[model samples]
Target: MADSVTADPAAPSATRPTGDPLLVLSGVNKHFGSLHVLRDIDLTVHRGEVVVVIGPSGSGKSTLCRTINRLETIDSGTITIDGEPIPAEGRALARLRADVGMVFQSFNLFAHKTVLENVTLGQVKAKKVKPAQARTTAMELLERVGVANQAEKYPAQLSGGQQQRVAIARALAMKPKALLFDEPTSALDPEMINEVLDVMVGLARDGMTMVVVTHEMGFARRAAQRVVFMDAGQVVEEADPETFFTAPRSERARDFLSKILTH
Candidate 1:
C-alpha cells in the first residue's frame, strides 16, 4: 500500500494561509564564533508545500533547521513563521515554538513517559489542554501514525521505528502550522528506515507544510514538491524533484548529486 498524506486546502481556520507563506527567512545569517554556518539565506514555504533539503554532512542543513525554531540563534537576519517574526526570547519564542513542531533524527522521547504521555505532555503543559482532552487528542495522533497499539508502552519498549513514529505523533499533537524534520530516519537501522519514511511521505502528500533534511534520494524524488541543494552554508540550487535529480543547474549541485548517486 502507498503511504501519503492528503490535506484539504480549503480547511477553515483563523490561522490558515492568507496566500502568504507559512515560513519565510530573509537574508538569514548564523555564526558560531568565527565560523559562518549560514549566510544570506532566503527561503519561503507555502501552506501546503513539502521542501526537501539535501547536502553533504556539515553543510549547514541541520543548522538551518535549528535556526528556524531558534534552537540555534541567527546572528543576523530574520525568520518568520505563520506571519509572526520569531521573537528572540521568553513567552513570544515559546509561543512560536508551539506553532512549529520539530522531529529530530534521534527519537527524543522522554524515557520514562509512555508513548501516550510523550504525546500529551506538551499539549497539556504548553497549550493548557486538560488532561482528559490531551489524552484523547494524543490517541488520535498515535492512531494516525499507526502506533495506537503501543500507546501505553514506554519508548524503550518499542523498536526504533515505533519510537520514531511516537516522536512524530508527539510533534503533531501540538497542531503545528508547519513541521521541521531533521534527518528523521537517519539513525534508524536500514531495515527500519522505510517505515518511518512512509509516515513522513504520508505527511507530505497531505500538504502539511514540511521542511525535511535528509539524504533519502528516493523519498525526495517521489514526495517532495521542491528539492533544495545546499553546500558549504549556501543554497546552491532549488528545483522540482524531477529537474533536481536529472538536470541540476549548479556545478556544486551537480557535484553533490554525482557523489550521492554514485555512492
Candidate 2:
C-alpha cells in the first residue's frame, strides 16, 4: 500500500539543502485493476515552486494531481508534505487535505450555499477557525479573487468564471501550504479562461507552492518555474518552461507540443 522509488540512492534524502521540500513523491506508482495509471513517478516540489504538468488525454496528469492530495490512493508509493509522510486515513488525512488545497475543472462549489458561505465552511468546520474569523478570511479571499461583490450569490447564479474563482477562494481560505490544480480552466469558456488564469498567476507571484495539471501552455510559460511532461503514466521530460517549449528533450514531448501549440 506504500513504497518509495528514488532516482539515486546516493542523492540527498530531500530535494534541496535549504530545507525539506514542500512536497515529495518517491518512486510513486499506481494502478486501477488491469490498467497501470502511474509508473515509477519521482517528483519533488519545493516551497514557492510553481510546477506545471502537461500531457495528452489519458496520460494520468489528473491522477498525478489527485494522488498528491490522496484523492486517489496510490497502490504503492510514498507522498510526503513538509517532510512528513501522508497518513492513509482518519484525522491525519483530514489535516493533510486541509494543508493541500485542490481546485478541480468542474468548480465543485456548493450550489445551496452562498459564495461567502461556501468559502467559510471548510475553514470553520475542518480548520476549526471561529465563525467570525472564517467569514473575515472568506471575504478577503473573495476580494482577492475579484468576486467579493458576488459574496451573497449562489453558485448557480454566477458565470462559470465567477464560480471557478469562488472555488479558488474556498481553497485559499484553507491557507494551504500547496495547491493542486486539475486543469482548473479546462471547463471554462474561452473568454473566461484568462480570468481564472489571472488569479492563479497572482497566487504564483505571491509564492504559493503549486502543482498544476494544465494544457494551457501560455500559463505555463508565464507562471511555471518548471514544466513536467507526462505520457502513458510516466514523466517523460521536465525542464524550465523556456526549454520545455523551445527544445523539449523527448520525442513524445516534441510531438505533443507540435499538436497542442499549432491549434
Clash count, predicted structure 1: 6
Write candidate 2's Cα lDDT for 117-160 as tens digits: 99999999998999999999999999999999999989999999
Best by TM-score: 2
Clashes of each: 6, 1
Over 4 Å off in model 2, which ranges?
Answer: 1-19
lDDT score for residue 250 of model 1: 73
What TM-score should be assigned to candidate 2?
0.93
Against the true structure, whose lDDT is highest?
2
Q: Score each candidate by Cα lDDT.
A: 0.85, 0.88
Give the TM-score of each candidate: 0.91, 0.93
